[model samples]
Target chain A: MSETNPPIKIELVSDPMYLCGARELVSCIAHRIGFDDMECSKIALAVDEAMCNVIRHGYERATDKPIWVTITPLSESDESFGGIEIVIEDEAKQIEPTAIKGRELEDIRPGGLGVHIIREVMDSVVFEKRETVGMRLTMQKRADRPEEAPRISSRSSCPIPAERRVS
Target chain B: MRERPIAARAGGFPLSNDNFIDIEHPESGVCVVIPRHDVDMSRSPILRSAIKDEMGSGLSKMIVDLGDVQYMDSSGLATLVEAMRGAKNANVSLYLASMNAKVRAIFEIAKLDAFFSIVDSRDEALSA
Candidate 1:
């Protein structure tokens, strides 16, 4: 609200199936804002991971619970610091972030890797647990990776008719 | 209606002849030659089980040749890592050969390229 050109728009939903849709929307937003493929992939993966946690870990198949997701563009100052801000909130359960530590490959059991993947892919991951409420997770990612290319598909070869080529 | 989990094969094991070819060697053990396309999350579970079944058949040394694989994702990487870990836990050896740049990028991103031994050819994966 403080002097940013167009205040970033927000989309809120409480449906589980919207999870996949949300990922696509983030990718579209990233593209509109000029984020590279790797950055877009990172955001998509982060969304999948977080939503998986909320669905599997927090609600445990209880579809009656609701999850909150907020997307906001960082202010000029925040952009200077790096990336967009994504916040996901859930009032289903209050769980400590530390409880979701990465297990060694030996202990690669099903259902525990989601939270670990979320923290690893995102640049900064913060988890807050409120009393008698749920947990909020905040994440940041750089809109651009210096080492990554612009993501033009390398296979540029296309078949052309000889008659068309002559023109 | 609930979306059925992706079924890799119909009334058969996960290793479809379309995606993998089984090869066996006396000295090096059994190897599965991965095909060129469709090596994504949908097939990872089947790939993992195929590797496990091969290991269970007393083929300690295993090789996965990704010479033709053009794309891979995190779940694919996770499957490969799990296969490698499974081999180690079972006291067997595992190797990969001819990883393409796009598929290899996933390994690099997952920081697993350094953890696994990769070679250029099937023979190399078998012998080394």
Candidate 2:
């Protein structure tokens, strides 16, 4: 929330093996933020998918490339509701943010469900291609606490915008 | 990096001493795989390759035991879907057994719970 309370940051190679560590880190953060078991698991899963996309699509499985993750706790004023924000940064070939789409569920197959899963679990997903190189993916989820209900944004109520949704 | 038999392809890439997965042949034509870690992008490849090898060997009935798997992401789900496709092509019956609560939730969220044959235990899966 402030400079003194910096977000948790983790840097790892683009290798898939680090994905497990990433998942564990996010899961711990989600639990510390008061998310329930189910919510924590979903958050962890969403974060994992986002990282996978960066490693596989953005970095093209180049294990030497670096991937950075930052998890910040958000206050109510940051958005209509208070929750957590996960930022994934990768220095790889830039991809069009709008072009990212997951495969249709009806067409059952492998390798395309990452985007869809992230979209489903998170309250909002935003993609931005960095100026010179790399891409940044930000996924936010509203805390499901009763006290946070009144300030919840109408936008946050919808998990994913239909336009950007894959499934 | 090291070459190992399908039996040793557990845990994930780089194959740690932790044994992330285990394989068993309960009966002829039946193979059971138990994953001991979270099935994400890092571990899905191991699962895919193992199932592919089983399909190649003409195994007709495959059961995946997810009782020990506490987490699974889309990549893991995609691996299962790919395995399903391979099984269909080989005329093999692929079943999922003992999915924990967290793993089951993901399948339900993706609406894949209806797509796969899910059972409470390996015995039920084998019987199904």
Candidate 3:
């Protein structure tokens, strides 16, 4: 992630076909941010999973719904950490930010692992509503990221929605 | 992924889209399923259907040869997880072979690395 370059914003429909191209974009961006192939692929997969959630649950698989993804690079001077940040905005019906989650690994089932993947790959994940409608997902990864990212199950440990935020 | 013998052309046949899956049985009672291209959300359904169809057909053991896949997302993982459950019930042994570092990491992140029987090469999978 770099501050010198402008952030990349992507707008597309909820259709799943476009996700492959989106993943390639994020992986390339992560590569430019100095991450290795493994990390880059993880970042791309995480973003892909997030988009799948928006398309699956938020949009109910409606191919025509809109989803916006903004990827901003962070500099080392900002917080003594340099990495990548991605914000996903969905125009689907807004739900309680806390309600967004995946199934527990302990249960061992399919269909709810996307949320787990996003939290496990990224450094920090925050959710805030887009004022009146839709939801915004803000996920950031630090350059000195964890070799093993933390799992999220306790909702209390998560950051709450800010009084004011952007989509 | 190490270079290993792929029954790529031996008794190969497509299940759904001809490009998605190539089924081959190199030896008796062993079936190898090779999923082509990146196994993302869009491609996952095809892979899932192919696996489901194979499981429905009686087989002693199955190996999902993933040497050709460069990438896989949660949807791909979900498809395999579902296959795992189906395999367990059907008493059909399953093994995942030839995953590159990148695809294997996706499994590790989901904490499923411990659950599946994964091998490094296709020959190992076939002989196991």
Candidate 4:
């Protein structure tokens, strides 16, 4: 049902103020695409984190740089299963795809929390150097799972695998 | 200012200089800081500053009332972390209260929920 939807493109400046509008738009689209409340928030958060990174690190906080956001639907044919795909493109600084590694969540005072959230919430996250854009960060959140859905802590009562079960 | 729709829903508070945060000191030894809008990078500094002022006010406990806030990004989270550290050094306990599901999810995603004392209600926060 969602694949028939057209892609939505938003052009914004490298300013934090624009983030609110972008998040609102993304949420509206995600909702229209049948994402539940929690699913909508996770997808919106993934896009928010990406834009913040581009504005802060990619553009060095310059307010005039251009940031492009494209939202498209994911389908089983696309191997995304089912969800929303957010593509954030920046124009100022070229980023090494491999350099986008998220810092350890164990570290309290590190700069990678944004990256970590992007990774953990989204089912698939990919970064690439686009021909026209300086960098392209593509993230997809499957409608099938929310970030809080799968988190059963080590202390949970779920049956443990015998290989790693406490003896 | 621009917020507070018609009148104080429950109560009112004084806004900081930048007008980004509303600080309510309901009683002695406790301070409550509420941001009037979305807590993003641009506005986190104002909140951080307000939190700093409260830290030095000799309050024994500080509560960040998140009931009014709908969205909070990473910068906002970092501000709270820094405030937590400052509160510790200043002998003030920092508590986060009434976070909506979205804001609470942000904290959980960052794995910092356990790091902060998050309560479901302001009364719970006040009494705890």
lDDT (Cα) of model 1: 0.59
- Once model 3 is optimally superposed onto the true structure by TM-score, how far is the C-alpha of residue A127 displaced, in angstroms? 1.2
Q: What docking class should model 3 receive?
A: medium
lDDT to native, each model: 0.59, 0.77, 0.79, 0.76
lDDT (10s digit) by residue, model 2, range B38-119: 7877677777777776675658798999988878888788899888888888888999999978899888878899999899
Question: Which wins on DockQ, candidate 2 or candidate 3?
Answer: 3
* lDDT of candidate 3 over B35-67, digit per residue (tens): 878888777877777787778656878899999
Clashes of each: 0, 2, 1, 0
* TM-score result, candidate 2: 0.84
TM-score (all chains, Cα) for each model: 0.59, 0.84, 0.84, 0.83
| Interface RMSD of each candidate, angstroms, one decimal | 4.6, 1.1, 0.7, 1.6
Q: What is the C-alpha RMSD of each candidate to the true structure, in Å?
A: 8.6, 8.1, 10.3, 10.6
Off by over 4 Å in 3: A1-3, A145-167, B1-18
Residue-level lDDT of model 3, residues A1-167, one tens digit each, is 34645789989999888897788788767766666667778888889999998899889989899899998877666344577889999888888889887678988888789888999999889988998889899998876654322221223332311211355
Candidate 2: residue pairs that collide:
B11-B20, B11-B21
Model 2: lDDT of residue B51: 74
Model 3, TM vs. native: 0.84
- Top lDDT: which candidate number? 3
Candidate 4 residue B112 Cα shift, in angstroms, is: 0.9
Candidate 1 per-residue C-alpha lDDT over A81-149 given as tens digits, one digit per residue, 9 for 90 to 100: 334667888876786677766655445433345555666677778888855698888877654444331
